[model samples]
Target: MPQSSNVPNGASAAPKAKYNRPKPVVLAVIDGWGVAPHWGGNAVTLAKIPFMNKAMQEFPHTTLQASGEGVGLPPNERGNSEVGHLNIGAGQVVLQYFPSITKAIQDKTFFSNEVILQGINQAKQNGKRVHIIGLVSPGGIHSHIEHLYALLEVAKQQQFTDVCIHAITDGRDTPPFVSQEFLADVTTKTQELGVGSICTVSGRYYSMDRDHRWERVEKSYRAMVEGVGPTAATPEAAVAAAYRDGFSDEFIPPTVIQGPKNTFKPIMDGDTVIFFNFRGDRAREITQALMKPNFEGFDRKKSVSNLYFVGFTYYEEGLPIHVAFRPHNVKKSLSGVISDAGMRQLHVAESEKYAHVTYFFNGGNEQPVKGEDRIVIPSPHVPSFDQVPEMSTVQIADTVIQNINRYDFIVLNFACPDMVGHTGNLRAAIQSCEAVDANLNKIAQAVAQAGGIFAITADHGNVEQMVNPKTGEPDTEHTNNPVPFIVTGNAVVNCQLRSGGILSDVAPTLLHILNIPKPAEMTGSSLLVVQPQVARSAASTL
Candidate 1:
C-alpha cells in the first residue's frame, strides 16, 4: 500500500537515536539528628519537620550507628559532623586517633616506642616550629588540651625553639565561652616554663556572648539600644543598653565574619598546621575554607597552600574511624588518662569510651550535591539560647546548593536535633526537630521536581530522648539509643526492603541507587528495593 516513489529506493530505513539511561548515584550522610543514645542533639525535635517524618515512615528508612561499633570513633566519641561525613563519603571505617598516642603521652606506653611522639621530638630538634594545634578540652573527645599541654612541656624540656598552639574554639565538649579560661591556664603553664611564648589567640567560638564571659550573648541590652522588642521603649533604656550583646541580633555594633580577616590575621605559609579533633567534622570546615573554596565562604590572600599537615582534623582525608572501645567497659590499655597530662588544669575530664562520632574533613572542597542528590536537615535552624549551634547548618547547605549540578551523589545532615539535645531544653530541641522536618520537605520537593531519588538515614540517635546534666540533674551524659533512616522518590519504586542498617552502610547504598560503581572501601550496602544485576542471579541461575 506504500506509494510507489516512497517504496522504491531499496527500502529506506529510519535513523535510530542513541539512548542512554541516566547514571545512578547514591548520596548518604548522617545529619545531627542521630545523637548517641545517652548524650544530646535531636534533629527530630528542632521543628515539626514533616518531611523527615514522612521519610521515616514512608520510605526505606533505617537506623544506623554513628559511633560505637558503627562509624567507629571511641564508644564515647559521640556522633559528630566530621567523623560521620568522612565515613559516609569514603564508605569505609577506620581508626581516627588510637588511644595508643594518648597512652604513650600518659606514660602508659613510654615515649621510648611511640612513633608519633618521637617524630614530634625529632621535628623539634630540627629547630622547626614545633606547633601543636590541639583542642583545649579535658573530655578526650577531640584534641585533648592536657595532651597538648604535656606535649608542649616535653617540647620545652627538649629545648624546642618555637612552640605554638593554633587553639580553635570548642563548644560541643565544654560549656560555651570557656576558651578564655583554658587559654589562661595554658598561658600560665607556658609562662612558668617560659616555653616559646605560649600565647592564647582568641579563637572565635559559635557562642561568644562577651569577649569571654560565659553567659548568653548580651541580647537584652542590644534590644534596648536598637529599639528591639519591649526592651527599647525609651531613649534612657537605649542609652543604658550600650554594652553590646554579641549573642542576639538586636542592636550591637557591627562585626566582621570571624576569620583571618578578623582580629586574627590569616595564617602564613610553612606554619605547620596540626588538626586535633579526635572525632573530625568541625575541624574540616575551617580547614577547607582555609585551604580550598568549594563554596564562596573562603576569604584569604590566596587559597590555603604551603604547609606540612598532621591529623584527621579535616575532610580531605575522607573516611570514618572505627571506635572499637566497648561501652561501660574499661579499656585495659591506659592507666590514668587525666593524671598523665594534667587535664584538670585545662578544665577537661578525660575518658576512653563514649558514644558520639563526629565527622571531620579537609573541607577545602566539600562533597558537591547535585541532580538526583539532596541534603535533608532541619529547615530554618533556630538559634539556641545563644546564636546558632553548629556551623554545619550554614556550611553544609552552602556546599550542597553551590556545586549542586556536578555530581549525582549527595549528603543531607540536619543538625537541630543534636544541637537542642545538648541544651537539654526540651522545647527548644523539639522546635529544632520540627525545623529540620520542614527543611526535609523542601529538599524532597526539589528532588521530586528534578525527578531524582532521595533517601534519609541517620548515623546515630539523639532526639528521641533527653539526657540530664552531670552535677545538677540526671542529664549531661548520653543514653544508649536507636535512630532511623528512610528512602523515597521515583527512582526507588517497587522493591522488597528491610530496615537493618549500620552507619557504615549509609554511603554504599547511594551507589546502588545511582547504579554507579561502588567503592569497595565502604562498609554499608545498597538499600534499594531491587538488587543490581551483580546482586541478582546470573542468566544460568535465572
Candidate 2:
C-alpha cells in the first residue's frame, strides 16, 4: 500500500540523463528456457531457437542465476516459477515458503505455531478427525513430503489420534511413476510415528487445478467429502490400480482407501482440514471449494457444517482461513513502482501461467495496481502438454502484439517450454521451444517497430535438461541451471550488460532503462552498464 515515488536505494540511483529511454518496455519471460552446459537432453540447444540465439549474440545479454540462494530457496534447490517471478517482481531475493517451514520444523517452532495448534486442539476437543491434504512429492515445488511428515509428527505430539492424509500424487514436478514409492514412504513414516492414515489418493490434475476447471476440483472434493470415487483396500492398492488403468501419477483418478471394517473415511462434520501445500497458486481453487460457504464452482452433494479449515500459507488475500505460516511481505515491487510512476502496464499469459504474470510478479499481491491491464488466454484442456507443445503462445503473442503500443510497460509469459518440458519428451520439448521462439520473434518485431525496448528472460529451467545424465532416463524435473537475459532495441544499442546477475536484478534493470530510480526496498542493482556521456546524449534525444 506504500506508493511513494521517492528513490531510497543508492544501489538503484538514477543513471546519467542522456540515454534514449524507450517507452512501452516489454519484459517477455520465456518460461523454462535456460543456458545448459551441453546438448545432452538440452532442448534449448537442440531446438531451432533462431531469434533467441541471435539476440544473445547481437544484444546486451547475460546469464542469470535462477536457482538456489539467488532466488531465496534453500542451497542447491532448483528454482520454481513461484520464487522466480516473486524475485523478479520484488527486485530483491524473496525468501520462499519452503525454507521458512523447514526452519520452523528444525527449531521446534512449527510444533508450537498458534494456528496449527488451534486446528489440532479444535479437532481433539470436538472428537472429530483431522484431515491433512497436499501434493505428495519430494520435488519441493508446491508441497514436500517432509512437510507432510512434520505435520503428522505434530498430530502425534498433540495426541490427535484420528487423522487422515488426502494424498495428491504429482508427476509434473517429479517422475511420472514415483507415486507408489512416495506413498510407500508416507505409509512407513505414519506407521513409525503411530499417527495418521492415507485415506484418499488422487493426482494433481484433479486436486490442484488453478485454471478454473470446476469439474476437476469437484472430483477431488467429492472423493474426500462424499466418498464418491473408486475404492481400494489400501493406499498402495489404490495407486497400483491407477497405474494398471494406464494412468500416470498426475492423472490418477481420485480413490478412497478403505479403513477398518471395510469403511471409507470421508470428511465429515466437525472435521478440521489442514491443507499442507506451501505454495498457494494450485492450492487456491481447492481451498475455496472446501472453505467458502457460498462456493459456486460446483455443487457439493451435501455441506459439512462446523468444518474447520487451515492452510500452510495464506492462499490469497481476504480468504477466510487460518494460516500456519504467513507469507513474507514484499514491498516496492516492480509493478508497484511502475504504477506509482503513473505508467500504464499490461500483464498477459495463458491460463497455465496467468498467476505468474499477475500474482507472483506483483510480489505476492493478488489485486492489480492502477493502470494495470491483465489478459489471460485459455490454455488447452488436454491431458498432457506434450500433446500440444504450443500451449497458447500464439494467442498470447497475438494479444501482446495488438496492444504493444498502448501500455508504458508490458509483461508476458510464454508457458509452452516449461509445461511441455515436464512431460519428459525431448522431441516435444524441442517443438515447444521452437513454438515459443517463433511467436517471440513476432512480438519482438512489433516492439521494435513501436520503438520500444524488449527484454527476453526466463523464470527457471525445465526444457533445457530433459534427461538425467546419471541414469540416462527422462528427467521431468526443473534443473538448477542459469537462464539467459537478453535486452534488444535501439535504446540500449551500445550498452554493456553486467555479468553475474540473478532474477532479482531484472526489475531494477527495467527501471534503469526507463530512467526511473529504483525503490529503497529493492536491494538488486541494475544490470545495465552505464556510461554517463552516452546515456546523457541518448536522454537528450528523448
Question: Best lDDT goes to which candidate?
Answer: 2
lDDT (CA) per prediction: 0.41, 0.87
Predicted structure 1, TM vs. truth: 0.54
Write model 1 residue lDDT over 453-495, tens digit each, in one string.
6666654455555433444331322334545556666555444
Model 1: residues with Cα > 4 Å off, grouped in runs: 1-30, 35-47, 98-133, 139-141, 153-169, 175-198, 201-410, 413-428, 445-451, 459-482, 490-500, 527-542
Best by TM-score: 2
Q: What tens digits encode model 2's per-residue C-alpha lDDT throughout 139-258?
A: 889989999999999999998768889999998888788899999899898889988889899999999998889999999999999888899988888889999999889989999988
| Global Cα RMSD, each model | 15.6, 5.2
Count steric clashes of candidate 1.
97
